[model samples]
Target: MTDRTDETDDTHRPGDQPEQHRVTDGGVTAAPGREGAIPEEDTNVTEVFPEGNLDLRAGADNCYKCTTCDTSCPVAEVDEEFPGPKFQGPEQWRLKRKEDADIDGSIMSCSNCMRCDSACPSDVPLSQMHNEARGEYVDDQMDALSTEYVRNRILSNYRTSAELASKVPQLANFAMNFGPARWVMEKVLGVTKEREFPEFAEQTFREWWRERGGAHVQSSEKRIAYFHGCYSNYNTPEVAKAMVRVFEHFGYEILVPPQKCSGTPMFANGMLDDARRDAETNVENLASAIADGADVIASCTSCSLSLRQEYPELFDIDGVEDVSDNTFEAVEYLRIYEDLEGELADAELDGQSFGYHGPCHARNQGLHRQAVELFRDVDGVRVEDVGDSCSGISGTYGWKEEKYDTSMKIGEEMFEHMKHAEGEAGMTECPTCAMQMEHGTGYDIYHPLELLEDALVD
Candidate 1:
């Protein structure tokens, strides 16, 4: 871990002589009399280094070693290899700073869910540090130019794969399911054949939006651009449709832009450069809509977290602050709308009961009860907080052969709870969690927006 904070700050004093500022990597030029600081005028240049390239200065200094993060880690409860977030994060951070080799491979298991950061009593940025270290470790160990690297890169650049799969849905779905093809994928790409992957849609959400002339919807006092992420656009267009219908019912003029993936899959799989590229494209695409005073909303909680929180925290892309400020999860947006305009349209669900699995990323966003609150507003819908447990399929983490068993193990508790819980169907904010929960318990699962859309009154 390289510490940038140890470098002296160039605070200008009246008597101090101006010094030349050097340009750093990624083309970011610093102002005169400063070190590694971005010029205020150049919004394109970022002062923040890409993930794993920079280290936190005194990041773990606040750690009292109370092990609160350890106790709170959902991953640690399942995998003993992960000595909990404290060991893999704060404690390991200290060891790595002293000696790089002292840090072990256990850090790779971190899902970068930011739960440890949230649970830390001393506010240690544990998850961030662990992610950074994982990057460093992989970079040192793996040959980036190798065939294995290429396969991993392909797996990580999920947007590209999804687009291709969507274009040839049947072939893609068959290839994924076929035994011989699965063996080839496991051998060549390190993707596991044991777990089921979500099938790509023949008609994506954006495709459906274009067919319906979704872009030309009449403008209203309340306006929003739907950031229907890759999963909705590729694998589950129904969820996106439900979101649009529900939003329209509430008098929101919805704008469906052709958007790229939220780059979370890339981030989770250690493909930092790919994630940065996707993030840049999205920020550029949303700039105009955001300037026109439209709130950017996403149905997927992970996508919302990526836009609303991860962009600034991980990439430090220019103009992302504006996007982050404007972005909202669909349910979060609904809650805000209700707060401003009074209760939502009294939608009748006919007394349907559902269990809610708060996605780990959603929980990381401090949205513990907001999903339930949104569901509670629906007439005759029962929404229970099934627990704050993780679904354990953190992005593409569970799809790799090496991680399949551990991923299933991590999700066992959540799966068991859902199996026994009383619910006609499962409700969640994440598409991946919905898939995992369904696979785990064989229950009909849905995003809450889907249910709300079905139950809309008048």
Candidate 2:
């Protein structure tokens, strides 16, 4: 089995000379020694701020020091050492652009959750500024071989790690569970031993789909392309299966198109160049599917957000807008494009109650109520909105050794909410949120589709 921590030559120095990088297929690529580095000129800040003449500083000027972003930040509420998004985002962004100032190291604490964006009255693009600043900081300040660098690289490339481990899942699980191995990982990779690693599935979703001859299904007029993301593909195929089963029962033909990770991990870990690559690849593939008369849907809220929002905001790529326009959160797609509420009206939940935790990404996309509304008219089924609280595990953010305490601290309210919620189980559209909630509270948490699948009548 490949060692998860073994460093490959994937580091990219985007701060290097522009001559060392070349534009290929609408993305910047670095020279041999600095592979995957995107040039500074190709940063693509214009996509988000078309009125700013391609300058991110214009957005920063909108902030009037309101502190709404500061108050909305979950990390600021928990970690005093970390400054709020107002400081890390717009405040520093102005200085960084005008004076060429270094990004405050606190920028890493922003978590890309977009709560600040949602809260800002002035509509400042705080998260986008922080993301760009993080990439700049990493390229300028971080040593390529340092512990932080290597650890983040490993975490950001989770798709590769998961793929390799899934090939030999028993051995991988044993190694993960083994105390000594975890100690070594803690010492070397800086992954906290306090939290258990998410185990790889014995069979990947793609593999299972292929084996079941799902790829051979006949095409239908109402066709959809599925982007299962890495979590559903590797850690929990059941989520993807439930989505597939539910969609198939609704008379839609599903296409599991080729896809990379949605790049949320990379964006969080300051691996923007790799993220750009993923965005490019996914946009190209999904766009082709869209052209062939299929709308894209993702069960993971983060994945859907990436497809529908992040790709267009972060990259100046072709067909991204079209891809974004067609992409939908699985539940949101069903609620909008299908008669989901009517179909589920006759479906029975048999006195089941669930606490629905709207994930940050889902709320960012403004589709947080889709899942709750689906069960509104169903008899004997009560789904409560347990408040919009950050789960503190922003994708891989909670798994790092240094952030574990802050992560738990930020999550305490959410954990408390679930413990006292009027349900035997909880439902969320985010995989990491589900993981963090289960770890924080003892209750089982599931994707909303999983419960809906069980409740669907023949």
Candidate 3:
């Protein structure tokens, strides 16, 4: 919000004498040689305020009170208490510039689904401003360490929890399903009792790769580095395996690089600092893989979005742009770089029908139609675009106790569409969307990679 843009003093000539001396924030007095001259050390203010680079505050000025974003927001339509993106994003962002501005409690209600970003006609980065504001609000409340804060912290770093739970997955799964444990989580941690937790796999994808001699496979000319995010690594290793199988069939050597969580949950929960750390780690590792003659890809749409878009937009880290340029979603990578349609032309699906619920992040990335088109190209496969509605489970948003009802409410339209749609099952690229779809409608949801993997011939 600070006016970091450099201003030019057009009134003074290049050889004009100094009129007055001014002291800068860095405690350096500028000896006026030219009108616009300032201390060289004060040029980069980001060193003093690292958070300056994380926010798109300047974009807030572009909002012209158009209600396009408001109408498109799924949360705003469902929750009246929540102000739409017009007020919550650019309008609130302007107010946040003041030191004494009161932070709206409703900002926490934002699902961060990013429909506002796509709907804005003025190219305003509405969601980015909201995300930064949420971080400010969370930091302000950290001293109290409220139950909601504690719950957010727990959910934000779900990678750690998943890793620990995966060690003894059966017991972990049992504890989650146990009624008394659920009550304890509900009462103490603010997790909702209505939603069932995702089950951890007995073995992780990395462990399976090592055990099955996948790590020793000879490198092919076409290589891809897989960024199997937390969900695919822990809860649904089968999806990761399906990706591996399909990629190998295309004669591409798979490289599983050392990576961390995609930081989608951290961003959604207003843990910008945590998300920055994740971006730094992932960019370093994925950039290294790219430097080694491999392209980066993720099966999870959120993970791909984090690597390909969020990191560059929210962080000023080295190699972030390079990593972003090279990263692609799994099906997207295949479609762009390989002959996916031609390769799958002969493959048969036996007339399977699927209702495709495009994830919000995928829509934000503008690649939602890629999967739909690819699936439609397959013989005897029916794919339906089951409306562009938010699943309301924006990562960890729906899991919180206070948000459970709101989350379900926001998802009602999508759930209704899925219930009536003629399909063998629901198909999507997001793990959390799959979970929410299954929860809302008593139907099985699967990643498109799993279906494509089964349909492809060896």
Using lDDT as the measure, which candidate wins?
3
Q: TM-scores of all models? A: 0.83, 0.86, 0.87
Instruction: Let me know the TM-score candidate 3 reaches against the reference structure.
Output: 0.87
Residue-level lDDT of model 2, residues 348-375, one tens digit each, is 7789888888999988888787778878
The C-alpha stretches of model 2 lying farther than 4 A from their native spots are: 1-54, 215-220
Error of 2 at 425 (Å): 1.4
Instruction: Report the Cα lDDT for residue 95, model 1.
Output: 68
Off by over 4 Å in 3: 1-57, 215-220
Residue 163, model 3: lDDT of: 91
Would you list the C-alpha lDDT of every candidate in the order shown?
0.74, 0.82, 0.83
Q: Order the candidates by TM-score, highest first — what do you get? A: 3, 2, 1
**Candidate 3's residue-wise lDDT over 1-458, tens digit each?**
11223234453333243445454444455665656666555666453212244544447656789799999998889888888888888787767664457668788889889888889887787777777778888887554468888889899999999999999999999999898899999999999989888899999998999898774345747888999999999999999999999888787888898889999999888898889887788889989989998999899999988887667777889999888888889998888888888878888877888888999999988877777888777888888888888999998999999999989998998998887788758989999999999999878888888887888835
TM-score of 1: 0.83
